[model samples]
Target: MSTRGKNHSEWDSISTLYHTVVGQLTIPIAAGLVDWVHETVPLNGPGANAMDNGCGTGIVCSLLKSNYPTLPVLATDFSSAMIDEVLRNAEESGWKHFQARVLDSRNLDSVETESVTHLFTTFMICLAPDPDQIVSEMHRVLQQNGILGLAVWARPNFGFFEAAWIEACHELDPTYEAPTLMDPEWIEPENVRRGLAKAGFKSVEIKAEQQSWDWENVNAVSTYFFDGHNPGNTKWHDSWTERGQSIDKVRPLFERKLEEAYGQSDGSLKGPVPFCLAIARK
Candidate 1:
């Protein structure tokens, strides 16, 4: 698996737009994670050591702080651009407990082995080329009996922004292959559990928690696509144009599908999509 760096600058360029798209989706996901933490580990009581891997813009960091006020967190990402955004958000939000750093998961040098009390990451495992290496690094860094919490998009069931994008892709390129940005290897519960066990973790449990990208209409989803914060804009734009499809043509098709699948009486899009979240212990 390639450890090639992510294009964080493109995401940074559209940070505000990205934040808008994520703001709604994040709260439910965080709420679900909070429930999972309560079930698996104690969020309060003692001073726990926690790390939010890929702490982009510090959304999860902020959520962790709200849930575990006494927890000392080390928030890290492979991209310095992401780290900068995390720092900025932390400063602006008055989050004083987190220490932000740029560190690749394949090789974590700054943190000592077996030091972290809990490892938390959301929507990140799928981005790695070698998730096993990342799991191993987590295993090395987390204390014995420490917990690992992760959240990932489940295969789209019912309706979702991702399904709308797929519908648009089919309209543009019939044979268009979705890139493995969220690599499926990490998406599967079996694969995740196996990797965690291989990395010396035990008592892994997985669950599906439904969530969604809510928008007024499909145009909002299309706007999110072109915003360039996601790999959709950075890696997929050229392929879309090469196939002779413009955003103008594709946008309406996606909107129509979304409307057909999940339209309101007033013609807006609303509802929660499904996601799979995993919790494991070392």
Candidate 2:
């Protein structure tokens, strides 16, 4: 079971913004992981079928189709908006072998048991209402000796941004409280190993690495957190609206904290992020 709350509607609301902003921002990471999957798995053989669970913007699916044109790819997401984007992109790219579907990760009833040869999910399991059930579903869908690839945020820390935002929010409204973004247990490598093992995966290997990106200035960081189409920002704005508080009241304070913690001498922000990559065999 997941410790974090599940909100399926949130993805639908931010689908467009996520594709245009957040999904684009994570392209490098997604591409690198795809490259790793290509090298780690035998995806070039005849009749190779791959599924991208929670395939946001169809980035990974696109990469797979480009690299192995003959491979059949199934890209699924919970958001209908996201599925539309994926299908549109696939059509525009002339990817005839790719398919997109609106799917819930925890219960992939549409997929058949032992039907998939390769399964890949990037930054998705952590958001599931039941990560364990999702893993079990993954195992159920994979054929014998099939490979599973997963990438999730690991040891996620906002550095100084979180404290700054919380403080600023409190200054604006005394009763302001931060919304929980993820289940902490999901980020731990051991927990991920246990979940996969419980789901009948074998030879699981989990690796953690630090990944970072730079923001041109505090404004960019602020835009990403407050204006970006992601769960955190959406929840933050919702909380403020529920409290009858204006985000503008704390914008300055948040910017000030950004400057204090991540601002470069030239007024830019350097953020170091962490992620965990895992692979297992069914």
Candidate 3:
């Protein structure tokens, strides 16, 4: 409960801004995850129960239902604000096949064991307090032969937003270990396969997708792209401040680096961001 409270607070603090920045990208990510799921799982059947864990603003749910109209989707997040936004979006979009719930991925007893037909997540696993526990819960919730689809940031091939964040975090503190690209470690096909196998899942497979973020304006790119993880806005605010550094101090360094890498843009900074999509069966 304490963990859930912290997750809820962290997400609630930036729910609006985070959603505005990431929601557009989520449509494609959700599509890619679903495509992987379809290829790995038999999703064509009727009355399939799918769970979208950590569904922020229900963007994944919206995209999933749009693609598969008959799937019974349980869209969940730990934050009430996120769930509220999801419910509102579902209502506005008239997504009757979807339902919103506030759920912590680390705890699956709230959801029946072996009840869900398919489990889906996007950009959520890394935020978890315990990635291994969350993955184990996902496996527990899944019915036999159920499918799992996940999208994570690829380390070496990730986008400028992440690259800049990495540089900024390091500049702030050379010894600081940056946040996990995905729970346990960075997202890799082989790593995901091994993790799933350890979780007692079978027939696990992973696919990689490289999605790019295009920036039109370079002036605001620093703030727009990295502010979510910016020292001032993130839970790491205290840690950054304790080290006598902050995103306020870190932005200029990031901007200079960007200029060096991409040159000055008139008003737009556009680049491709790559993401990895992993699919496994339980």
Worst 10 residues of 2 by lDDT: 1-10
Tens-digit per-residue lDDT, 1-282, candidate 2:
001123355677677767565564467777777766667777886667999998877778888888887788988888777787777777777886777777788888889999999899988887657888888898999999899988887743323356777777877787888776656667778988888888899998888775666778888778867776677567667877788777787888888877887778988887666777788889
List the candidate 3 regions with Cα displacement exceeding 4 Å: 1-7, 156-159, 162-186, 225-238, 263-266
TM-score of candidate 1 against the unseen true structure: 0.86
Q: Show pairs that collide, candidate 1.
A: 211-273
RMSD vs true structure, all candidates: 4.2, 4.7, 4.0
Candidate 1 colliding pairs, count = 1
Quote each prediction's TM-score. Answer: 0.86, 0.87, 0.84
Per-residue CA lDDT of model 1 for 128-182, tens digit only, reads 5687788789888998888888887655222365566677779767887655446
Q: Is candidate 1 or candidate 2 better by TM-score?
A: 2
lDDT leader:
2
Can you give the lDDT of residue 113 in candidate 2? 95
Top candidate (TM-score): 2
Q: lDDT score, residue 183, model 1?
A: 65
Stretches off by above 4 angstroms in model 1 are 1-10, 156-159, 169-173
Residue 141, candidate 2: alpha-carbon lDDT: 96
